[model samples]
Every structure is written in C-alpha cells, then in structure tokens.
Target: MPRLQGVDIPTDRPTAVSLTYLYGVGPKTARELCLKAGVDPVARARELTEDEVARLAALLDKDYTVEGQLRRQVTQNISRLRDIACYRGIRHRRGLPVRGQRTKTNARTRKGPKKTVAGKKGVKDLR
Candidate 1:
C-alpha cells in the first residue's frame, strides 16, 4: 500500500487505478493527476519513486479538494440545502431519494424495509 493524501492506495493496481481510492478522485481525475505529475499512469503503485509520489501528492494538495475536505464540503452543501428547505433538502431530511428517483418501486435501499401496517379488513390476507 502506498499512502497518498492520508489514504492508502493499493500497490497491486496501476497508479491511475490506485489513485481512484482517494475520495472525490475517479479514473479520469487520477489519469489527469498522473499526467500533471509526470507519473506513468500504468505504473504499479509500489513501483513509484519517492519523488514521483511527492509530485502526485503535491498536485493533489495544491489543485484538488479531496478526502476529508471534499466530504466536508459535500455535507455542508447538503446541509445548506436542507436549511433552505429545498425539495432535494427535504428528501435528504426525510431519508428518501433526492434525484427524482421513483419511490413507488425500487427505493428499498433508501426507504429501508417496509413497515407492515395492520389493516382493518382483508388487506393482511392480500399478502
């Protein structure tokens, strides 16, 4: 494992792929970082020299908001939305999908297990 920006990137994968382990960094961003840092994207993480790792870390710290900072920024944005009572904010506050995903069917991950309600008549038997 190679530690970069407080995260340990997997040594088994290519540098580009391993860099994606950092928060807010994806394959595209990782490739861009490698390009800017003059690192070989296809190189394995363990194969990187100290100077190369230093360059990668410097580029990320100087030009990108990632890891804890990115997470905090996102949470703050969500909280701002919630405080403003926006539609998306309400969804977050209510623990529902926020991106116009239909809740009538496949929102189980957000809605959690169905809460069974006792019915007055034959509704229970319908199950």
Candidate 2:
C-alpha cells in the first residue's frame, strides 16, 4: 500500500482506483491527480516509484482539501449550522435526514431502527 496524505492506498488496484481510497478523492479526481502527477492512471499502485508517489502526495497537499482537513471542514460546517439552529441544522442535530428526504419511509439509515409504539386498543376490547 502506498501512503498518501496519511491514508494507505491499495497496492493491488490501479493507481487511479487506489487514489480513491483517500478521503475526498473520487474516480474523476483520482484520474486528474494521476494526470497532474505525470503518473499512469492504469498503473498498479505498487509499481509506482518513490518519486512518483512524492509528486502525487505533493499535488494532493497543495491543490486539494483532503483527509483530516476535509473531515474537519465538514464537521465545522455542520456545527456552524447547528449553532445557527436553522432547519437543516436542526435536522443534523436530531440525526434526521437533512436533504428533504421523506422520513415517513426509507430513512432507516438516518433514523435508525424503528421504535414501534404499542398498538391502539380495539373498540370491542375497550368496550
């Protein structure tokens, strides 16, 4: 594995694919990085030379907000929203879907497991 920006990219995959392992670098960005670094995007990560790795790392550091920095920036943005108590901020604070997703169904990922309420009594049973 090649360590770039404090993350270990998979050596078994192509360099472009491996670069996606780093936070905030997706396929398009990975290809761009390979191009910018003058490294072969299709080359296996394990086959990259030390100088090539250094160029990739340097490019990432200089041109991109990635890894810990990106994580911190996102958290900070959310926290700022929370502090302002906007609708979106409230959603974030409450652990609900923030993107106008219908919470009536299919929000299990954000809403967690269902907490079923007790069924209402039947009219006959109440009588």
Candidate 3:
C-alpha cells in the first residue's frame, strides 16, 4: 500500500481509478494530479515510489483546496444559511425536502418511513 495525502491507496488497482478513494478527488482530478506529478495514470498505486507519492501530494496541496478545506467550505456554507434563518435553512434544519419537491406523495427517503394516523369516520386514510 502507498500512502498519499494521508490516505492509504490501493496498490492493486490502476492509479487513476484507485486514487478516487481520496476525499475531494474524482477521476478527472486524479488524472490531472497524476499528469502534474509526472506519474502514469495507469500505474498501480502500490508500485509508486516514496518520491512519486511525495510529488503527487505536493502537487495536489499546491494546486487544490481538497479534503479538509473543501469539507470546511461546505460546512461553512450550511452554517451561513442557518445563521440567516432562511427558508432553505429551516428546511435543512427540519431534515425535509428543500427543493420544493412534492412531499404530499413522495420524498419518503428524506421524510423517513411513513407513519399512518387513524382517520375519523367517513374520512379516507392517507398514508
């Protein structure tokens, strides 16, 4: 196993495909990182030398706000919404659908499992 950017990379898979396991890295970003670090995209992660891993990490650190930084930015955005008490923030706080999707029928995944309440006489039950 080779470690890059504090992540243990799978050596058995192609570098380009395997590097996606790292936070904030996708296929396209992995390819670009490999190119910038002078590593072959098709090379196995385990086969990389220490210098290669160091170079790759350095390159990514220099050029990208990845992993913790990116996660923090997203958290900050949500925090700002909460601070402002916006409608979207309230929706997020309630853990309900925020995009105006029809919740009367669908959105069970967000709303959790349906709980049926007993209906009054002559009233149809709505699940």
> Which model scores highest in TM-score?
2
Could you tell me the lDDT of residue 113 within candidate 3?
79
For model 3, residues 57-105, the per-residue Cα lDDT tens digits are 8987898877778889988998888789999888877777878877788
Q: What's the residue-level lDDT of 105 in candidate 1?
A: 80
lDDT of every model, 2 decimals: 0.91, 0.92, 0.84
Task: Please identify which of the two predictions, 1 or 3, would achieve the higher lDDT against the true structure.
Answer: 1
Task: Report the alpha-carbon TM-score of model 3 versus the true structure.
Answer: 0.78
Which candidate ranks first by lDDT, i.e. highest? 2
Query: For residue 39, what is the lDDT in candidate 1?
Result: 94
4-121 per-residue lDDT for model 1 (tens digits): 9889899999999999999999999999999999999998999999999999999999999999999999999999999999999999988888998888885598778876656645
lDDT of each residue in 37-89, candidate 2, tens digit only: 99999989999999999999999999999999999999999999999999999
Q: What is the TM-score of each candidate against the true structure?
A: 0.85, 0.86, 0.78
Please give the RMSD to the true structure for each candidate, in Å.
3.9, 3.9, 5.0
lDDT minimum window of 10 residues, candidate 2: 118-127
Clash pairs, candidate 1, are: none
Residue ranges of candidate 1 with Cα displaced over 4 Å:
113-127
